[model samples]
Target: MQRVLIRSIFKLSNQHATKPYLLQQHQQEARINSISCYYCVYSSKRGQQENDGWGKSKRHFISLLTLGIGLGGIGTAYILAKEVSALEKTATNNDTHENWHKERRTDLPTYKQEQITKHDTLEKRVWVTYGVGVYDITEFIPKHPGSDKIMLGAGSAIDPFWHIYQQHNNKEILTLLESYRIGNLDKADEVSTEDMGSPWGNEPKRHPLLKPASERPFNAEPPLSLLAENFLTPNEFFYVRNHLPVPVIDAEGYELDIEIEESDTTRSFTLEEIKKLPKVTVTAAVMCGGNRRSEMTEVKPVKGLSWSGGAVGNAKWSGAKLRDILLAMGVESDEKRHVIFEGCDLDPTSHPYGASIPLSKAMDERGDVILAYEMNGETINRDHGFPLRAIVPGTVGARNVKWLSRIIISDSESSSHWQQNDYKGFSPSTDWDTVDFTKSPAIQAMPVTSAICSPSQGEKVQIVNGCINVKGYAWSGGGRRIVRVDLTSDGGETWHVAELEQEDLPDGRHYGWSLWSAKLPVPSGCKQVEIWSKAVDSAYNTQPESFKYTWNLRGVLSNAYHRVKVEIE
Candidate 1:
């Protein structure tokens, strides 16, 4: 029995380090401990039975106990150390990109494709080469955190940003970007490392159409008129609001780790593994919580990205259901309150992008939340989360996190700064000095909103037969449908019912926008026309007539009636 117990300890030690090298070292320690235990037990028992040698037996017993305890302790410690080292090695090997080209360069594109891929304006074919690799980035241009700054590399090399943005130098970014890899750049055309000096010097080219908010962590929106041109906003024209520089992820190495609150086990899923699950496609609109914030500044100079009405877009997304994945991962149906999502993108301050949604909303069969890999029928581009992203339909854009890396089912909300300190609403009396974020809940489902896209602010319009045409988009959150759109040529005194263009969707499932147009007669002999538009939803939600009563310190949820003035010269 004693020998069997010692053998069991040795067997346990072997389990700690399964790697051949570490296992060998651990086995050697186990053998020594086993030998010592056997000799000590055998000698101590034999000495106890000899009555005439009592004095010597006492000394033997004492020594036997010390040797057995000390050697057992040493063996246990060595086994633990080896186990930890093995775990560290696994993480290191998974993330390293050394010799990446030699191992994963099979499907790259040629030099001719790189040159012809430039000029995305017509064919909408955007490609860029980085370190002898080519990537198609057309889908990412509009959703890019820097907006059109990404366009500067269209049909060209990414060397300019690579040299200037020090963050892109790491292996994680190189691996993350591999998911978008289509082909290889010809060796001769690839920029040599010696010649790839920082030419732009941290300054990226700004998009001509975007109104600059801040130059460094680029923030901008397209001109208001261009935003209303299409029901589905073009990717390039979509407004971008970013809190950090974008992160590149190796598509092959990407994993979405889910922490099951019940089991306390973090299970990992690859992008391909997620793709194989049952697919769900949703058409939804994602609008920034700060969309139309610039108008709120008119009430008071509030602090935030200066955005107009252009900060929203509708897209079709395809991916595995978040609810399905969570259930399959063994999370108890009743265990969580909020489902927290974390993105791989990190700020210099070491904060990863994060948000949380109510568990009720996340698990609702009709909620349509997904771990999306494809946007608009194509694989998601790198700038917008190449391998995977979370699409929470009809929610604020911030909650629809990009570069998603983790899904946590928990009883409490996320502790992220974005969730705790920002994106919440405040009363009209609230000011920066006296405001408390905890007093108000975070802004979720956006309020009923509409924006005038045509006859842009301060434009001249020709009155043909005393009539002027007006057009724009209207949408509401919480699955509410836009029931009516009112257009006014004379500032709400007399309203014209605009004809709404929309798809025939099921009842209680309207999540996209409605493009409306109306031909309203110009007031007799007026030199200028003031056009105002507001939409009414099925729930009777409508925009405020003025922004003054609704203005808050953070400049959020600006849903006032959209007004544009045009001269009738």
Candidate 2:
């Protein structure tokens, strides 16, 4: 088998040695076509020899060599074959090479660091390295959930970017990436994981009580039982939804940049300067757009962190009101413009997290937008955006950019990936391949949502006076107060109104969530009961009966009837 492999390499080299190194585009195309044809014939021949165990291995070896020739030339293919033979002879069972040498197959072609860099352009080809594997992701770029952000890893290692967006660090994504693998990276060119220090090394300590949805970017929410225990969620128990490592900033040296795009004027304000401005406190509930994504996944698999009912929290945020600051700066409000907020937390490419709200919302007296420095009457911690943060009351949490650094007034919306591609809703029938992000507007204010928190799913409950006590929280966005909460103990067959503890804010300015409790009647001789809750907002908007119709690719804005099953005692 070894002699045959060597002879094949020499024969291919001789055949291509006379060709003048494929400089023309037509010549490259012809070379690729010929190599592909050769691969098909070679594979068919190997398929016929099923009796020999070496046939399958030989086919993989030939496939890698042909891919190399198509990518570079015959000389590159020769080098790749030699590297594979060398690896097979000397590769050990160490942690570094275990995955690469799996299944006793070490015939994967190898490419140099510089060779991978040359294929960076989409026109040429898009290649990226993860560990020792090199993948051609050009075909997958358009289908990437994060949109063109995947291009940032072109001609480079995707390890760093995965460090920021840890959701991609899963088996399903790995399997998809493996289908695009064309070769392995040369061992000499491999960068050890230890050498690439962790981006999350500076992350702040978090409360142990918070249940994490992910650990690297550190997304977590409070336990549902503890969520509605108080009207104002405790700072330590407040849910955290981070997209990147928490940025470390010096509070004393912090500066917020304010940019006016029309005039191209920029101004900086120090922490002290911002503190000098009049401070206002607004009690608001910030909820993740995918708060109930886990439940949606039960109906159908969705793409996002699997948050339960605890991703929403109410707090008193204290900071300089955005309207007051804009007025003092002599900025003119235009409804057609947008107020963009950028966070200091950056991705692998140094792009800060950003989002935008309409200028009308920023300037509206009742909008209640603020550059918050305190939460729940205490100094904001690093996990919650320490030095400064944007508090866009009644808006999705994505728009409330934390680690607040810059504010831009522009005529257009933010160009951030989260703004343009993510955090948007789509039709239930719209799948990932057919979904057009631009067609759907970004989620701003959320709809009415309620959940049953106290009984805890699958817990055994004792019937007291033919009724079971229930407690949970209900909220709506855009200052649309939750007007009513209804509970059903028998699959919506009958309903009982829940008594709500609501804030005394005026109409259209009720930003905080409402805590509700009820005593639901249980049917006689029942072994189990399913509890459901739904809320009605000020505009009479109520949650959908089920997540089936509300399902989308990204699972944002999933406000369905919250349900939990319990065993009757």
lDDT of 2 by residue, 235-306 (tens): 999999887667666676677889888888878888789989999999999999989989999987776778
Per-candidate TM-scores read 0.64, 0.82
RMSD of 2: 13.7
Lowest-lDDT window of 10 residues in candidate 1?
A: 59-68
lDDT digits (tens) for residues 16-124 of candidate 1: 1221221222233322111111101221121111111112211110000000011110110000011112212222233455333223254332544324343445254
Estimate every model's Cα lDDT from 0 to 1.
Answer: 0.62, 0.72
> Clashes per prediction?
10, 0
Candidate 1 global CA lDDT score: 0.62
Q: Name model 2 segments beyond 4 Å from true.
A: 1-105, 163-170
* Cα lDDT for residue 350, candidate 1: 27
Candidate 1 TM-score, C-alpha based: 0.64
